[model samples]
Target: MEQAEIQAHQSTYEKEIKDQLDIPLETLWQDAPIEPNWGIKKNSDGKNTFWFWFGFKGHLAVTTKSQYITSRLMTSANLSDSKVATPLLKKVEDQFPEHFTTAILDAGHDYEPIYRQLQGDQMGAVIPYNVRNEPLMP
Candidate 1:
């Protein structure tokens, strides 16, 4: 087979894998719920030092170089950041499909499924989870 043919085969395989794992955006939105009455308080030295008195916590998607927030998702504080990644990403894709070239995420957003989905779209994912105890480059 020619090099172009091999590349096409590889691309087709990746698309199939992505399709199998993709979750509909509507489903994702329905699954994520907001708690209006939720609150948190942390006490230190006999005084309240930190408080989330009401409302859900927010997950923000910002441009790495610009530091501008592009999108936001509200979720219960109890939810992990990783869980919100997909839906938030879908929203971003819908709004600016051609603008995003890379996704720079923290350790909290490190997950295999997320990485796979991002890469499948030709988006660079910079998540350092250290699953194999290997040192990450600086």
Candidate 2:
């Protein structure tokens, strides 16, 4: 192809990618509804613990056994971990559909909707949240 044609093709490809990856302006600037788990607090032992103030929170998906980080998502700190779990999992699923079969998350990701969605997708979930006083079986 001619140099001009090649340049035109490259420009078109770049535009297409930019369009696909674009986020809405409102969503980009939206703040979390509440303050994050930051600031200093005194523990029961009278020791002060200081948590750094970060505007955003990072969620990471790692291999269970290997501990290799596979995917990550960043959101405003005010957003709960449960709120972003599905979106982060969906991104990972899109990237590696055939690799992951189960997801193990903490209590913060113990939302029923997330569990149901994972179940619908034939994915196993291991979330330990104490809705009742019963112990969760492994």
Candidate 3:
């Protein structure tokens, strides 16, 4: 493709990534309770990025050994992933008491409260550092 064509394609790709859907609301039909929400994406360097979309997010608790999903929660895309972690874990814990000993999550769930909740339940947390969440020096 020509340079202009490449640039145009890149622009279109970026636009699509930013706004996943552009359908007319009047023409759209939905049976489930869906909502528009923004989500974060970590780059290769672990830097925080963002995107907007209209849909639901599926939070699940899976077993490492059996690779089976024990608990699941579906929420609007606007819901923070961190917010769902504890509840999902609680569901699993309540459903299958003492079945899991650890919770492995990504940097998106690097919140301190999540850590405390897991610790309170005697569960280990393995979440990486999310620098974006760190407090800046004065």
Colliding pairs, model 3:
none
| Stretch of 10 with least lDDT, candidate 1 | 11-20
Candidate 3 matches the true fold with a TM-score of: 0.65
Instruction: Looking at model 2, report the run of 10 residues with the lowest lDDT sum.
Output: 11-20
Candidate 3: misplaced stretches above 4 Å? Answer: 1-50
* Candidate 2 clash figure, as a count: 0
Candidate 1 local Cα displacement, residue 95, angstroms: 1.0
Q: State the lDDT of candidate 2 residue by residue for 53-94, as single tens digits.
A: 656677788998899888776655645566556555666766
Local lDDT at 79 for model 1:
57
Ranking by TM-score: 3, 1, 2
User: Per-residue error at 24 for model 2, in Å?
Assistant: 14
In the order shown, what is each candidate's alpha-carbon RMSD?
12.0, 14.9, 13.8
User: Best-fitting candidate, measured by TM-score?
Assistant: 3
Per-residue accuracy of model 3 over 41-107 as CA lDDT, tens digit each: 4465745765556767887889999999897767667666665665666667668878789999998
